[model samples]
Target: MPRFFCCLPLAVGVWLFSLLFFAWGTVLTVVGWYGVSSYERTDLALTRRQLVSLIITTSSWTLLPLITLFGMGAALARSPRALKAYSTALWFQFGFSVGAGAYFIYNLFRRNDGNFVTNCTSRDIADRDTCQQAFNVLRGVIVAVYVVIWLIEIWGGVIVTQYATERFQRSGGGVQFSNAPPPQGPGPVILDPVMMPPPEPPILGPAPPGRFAPNASGRFTPPGGQPQPSFVPTAGGVSLPPIIPIGQSAPQGQYAFAMPQNAHGPGAANQV
Candidate 1:
């Protein structure tokens, strides 16, 4: 199975939630900046330093969620570069969170006497108390948001690291095998011997008309309608014998005529 199948849902969820978190932080930062810039000294409760700190804190919140977005994209793409980018962003955000959290805790507890009085005004006691309460509530909410962002960054980092490792291992010569077994070391090849048909006997055509084959029993008959005597082998040497055709008369002689001309010469009968 592909690594994407296992990680896609988590990546998508992180992307969506990061977008919402980024938007929320951006809106809060923008509103706080506008409020601090527009309000007069008498109307404004927080000092310039406090306003600056608020902007810084909210801007960090806005920026940190983008790490999650980066991590999501890295996971989806399964790219080593993207994963490295996400890791850098995550560590940077984590460090920023630690610093910001420290600053906020110091200001909230040590300098402000454990009361969120940055946004309070001395002109109206009721408004001052209300502003302090509101600041406290907002501070708590931002702290929770930071915690959530931390968790998201950690989770995203783990997932991206896992996927990147998987891709690396796959690319770095990880073998995938099918049903067939791998070949062993080199060995001598044994080929099957081919079977061939026996060589054909040489073809010999029919005997000539005036010739008799060496092994034939009949006499040689020439084309002129005349029977000729032929030799038959016996215990003795060659001896002429009479051989008369059934439809022809014998010649007036003690034995039949001699062998036909050219019977055993260059125009001899074809060998069977």
Candidate 2:
């Protein structure tokens, strides 16, 4: 599930609770103002000092709660202004509660001596004591509320810090959140296999015959047949030269050489 979905209801609840405080503060402020305005300032009534103290107490109660309400609204809206406002409100509440608690404690201790409840000329003696007891009770309640507010402020501060950190990171600034895992580095690179072209087919033809073909010794021989003698052309038309063996002379009359008629004696051809 998304983080926002889980947190949405909690945010809405805080907003509603702050709204309740706002209403409470408004009612207290109205009541304080009404009491101050309606109370007659005659010498027989409540003294000026007691009236001023009452006004200060009521104003602190009213103003701090309203400030807390504004802080809660800023927190719910997730505004950047929330941090300062919430912190201020928390501090104000804490200071006011401590001061009021201390004053009431002193008042309680001095009640017998008539320090706080002495000037109640408009009310019965029993009612004056009841009023001091009520003030002490209210002071205790405010202190308790301050404690709750402090805890809430601490929790809200953590949430706001987390959100602000995350937002800063997303905007390409600040460091990562503590709860988030660190990122892994880059992965290994992959290379593609190379492709090659196909080989060509062998040529087809007839082989050479007989002497042109290679023998067992890989040498070629001439065609096998008897050798023919070559004839030469001369003035006597054509003639064949006698083949004499090496180192042997030709026989005197076994073969006759034909001489050209022009080279013979004048009557040698006629005589033959």
Candidate 3:
């Protein structure tokens, strides 16, 4: 479920209402400034009474397309960041349109001496009735204008809501926002070969004499003496190890393991 309200439509509707309304107000403002109406006659007191309604109505929706451009740009360009202010503007415009429209319409029908109290009063003595009559028809037209704008605004309010919902669903977005592009995949992984030697068994404490061991510096200390090469013997032109098989005896004149000093007795070596 989406937790955030997407109200772009409401914002747009409110903007259009305000732009068109203020535009209508601008016309009234000019009329009051120049002190003239349809027949070059207007009364200050009566004009003020008429202005109490304070609303405008426009034909052809002249501002709609321009408003659409600005509204969508503000929304999509800045997005979620701008939504707060946009919402506030929406409410203000909507409230003003409803409040002003209602006040004006209510007073438009108010009667005074058979003349609508909130309508034009003529200043011309000679053409007073004619000027007032022209204002009467113009007033109806003006009132219709206001009603149309108000109705359109109300309809816009509802439509904008649906538009926001449909856009969200169609775009598969949450919180009434358009979807943003997904992030790119990570860069390729690299494999490196490291040359390392496997660990050998540790030599504990002090090794026995003549055994491989580490000295104080942590390097292996060689045996006390230089290493002696393996020995091989030759008998009848065949190479043999220093010691032969236990069950075999050497040939009569051949030697296997030679006696160190003498054979068996002092005279044994003399006999060999």
User: Candidate 2, overall lDDT?
Assistant: 0.50
Model 1 alpha-carbon miss at residue 194, Å: 48
Task: Please write out the lDDT profile of model 1 over residues 188-231, one tens digit for every residue.
Answer: 54433233222212224654433333225445554455555554
Candidate 3 regions exceeding 4 Å error are 1-49, 52-72, 78-88, 113-128, 166-272
Ten residues in sequence with the least summed lDDT for candidate 2 = 194-203
**Candidate order by TM-score, highest to lowest?**
1, 2, 3
Task: Give the root-mean-square deviation of each candidate in angstroms.
Answer: 19.7, 28.0, 18.4
Question: Candidate 2: where are CA atoms >4 Å away?
Answer: 1-9, 38-49, 72-76, 113-272
Q: Rank all candidate structures by their lDDT, best first, as comma-separated numbers.
A: 1, 2, 3
Q: In candidate 2, what are the lDDT values of residues 1-272, reduced to their tens digit?
A: 11323666434444544565567667767876776786574322334554665566666767756676676767566664463456556566647755654564454344443443454434554576675675566557756755675565455444444544443454566555487678989765432222222211221342223212224453322245322233333443433332334453322221145555676664344332
Q: Which residue ranges in model 1 land beyond 4 Å of their true spot?
A: 1-25, 28-44, 65-76, 113-139, 173-272
Please, what is the TM-score per model?
0.44, 0.40, 0.37
In model 2, the Cα lDDT at residue 24 comes to 60
Task: Please identify which of the two predictions, 1 or 3, would achieve the higher TM-score against the true structure.
Answer: 1
Give every collision pair in model 2: none
